[model samples]
Target: MREEYRGEKGTTTTGFDLGRVMWVRKEPSHDGLIVPKAEYEQEREEYKGWIAKEIELRGVPGQLHFKFVRDTMRMNTDGVLMVVDSSDYAMIGDASAILAETIASFGNIPMEVIANKQDRNDAASPQEVASWLGVESATGTCAKDHESAKNALIRLLKKLE
Candidate 1:
């Protein structure tokens, strides 16, 4: 998180870039545990397209690689920085626990979450998210908003430091 840029305002610090993953919500059918088959299939195809696009943007070679466990999707990473956004779903099996477990499973790498449109919800706050993810710290940000996201990036970088 060291300052990597200089300007009239002085030094600017940047955060690491974590790979991105989009989580989609599945609609349930008659069975509470099961999502409607057609709806689920539609979402599946959409996400697959998204993953392919991300790999292309990254310019990765060979076929794109990924998997899902406990409703969370993972990218095949070989020790590279990754940033995961869970804005696609409202709540994924306890955000805090899921994030903690994900990071742990990913070898304790510095990970971040952007609570997209989080301000819309009266109940969920960044601090609440931090507490839930079992992370001592986290930033609440809207990815669509550049200014807010930039500030969040700074915080994430500082955490790395």
Candidate 2:
């Protein structure tokens, strides 16, 4: 995926806003399967899980927009994984405020913060990011390190569970 940023001209590098909203259909996958209602519901749940996994596997690139983030949270979200750039101290305050507002508006949902870009020389520490975000825990991650990224994701998922 291509990296997109919000430009000063109220435009984004990507044609559309990088934010994404995923919705899971509750309806059965097959119309003529003739399965029991309970069975169909179970299958639908499994399908939703599969879809979520697929999305995670095929990651998208884009900055999160407040509107889009709100819309996505309105869906059947089990948890939220917030990724922050540890090197961008200037944006941290604004981002933290928005995150706090979103959390308050949406109710207390499971959330985990990932302090990314640890490879940068000027990147803030995980503890510093956590403090700035008002989160008790934040996973440290270097995007270039596949193992570190994967481990951080796993830790967040574990917390969600």
* Residue 100 CA displacement from its true place in model 2, Å: 1.1
Among all candidates shown, the one with the greatest TM-score? 2
lDDT of each: 0.43, 0.61
- Candidate 1 lDDT, tens digit per residue, 6-102? 7635444434432332222232111112223344455666544331212111312111222233224346542222232334344544444445555
Candidate 2 lDDT, 95-120, residue by residue in tens: 67667765876677776688898999
Candidate 1 TM-score, C-alpha based: 0.40
Clashing residue pair totals per candidate (backbone < 3 A): 6, 0
RMSD of each: 20.3, 10.8
Model 2 gets an lDDT of 0.61
Runs in model 2 with CA error above 4 Å? 1-66
* Cα lDDT for residue 157, candidate 2: 49
Residue pairs in steric clash, candidate 2?
none
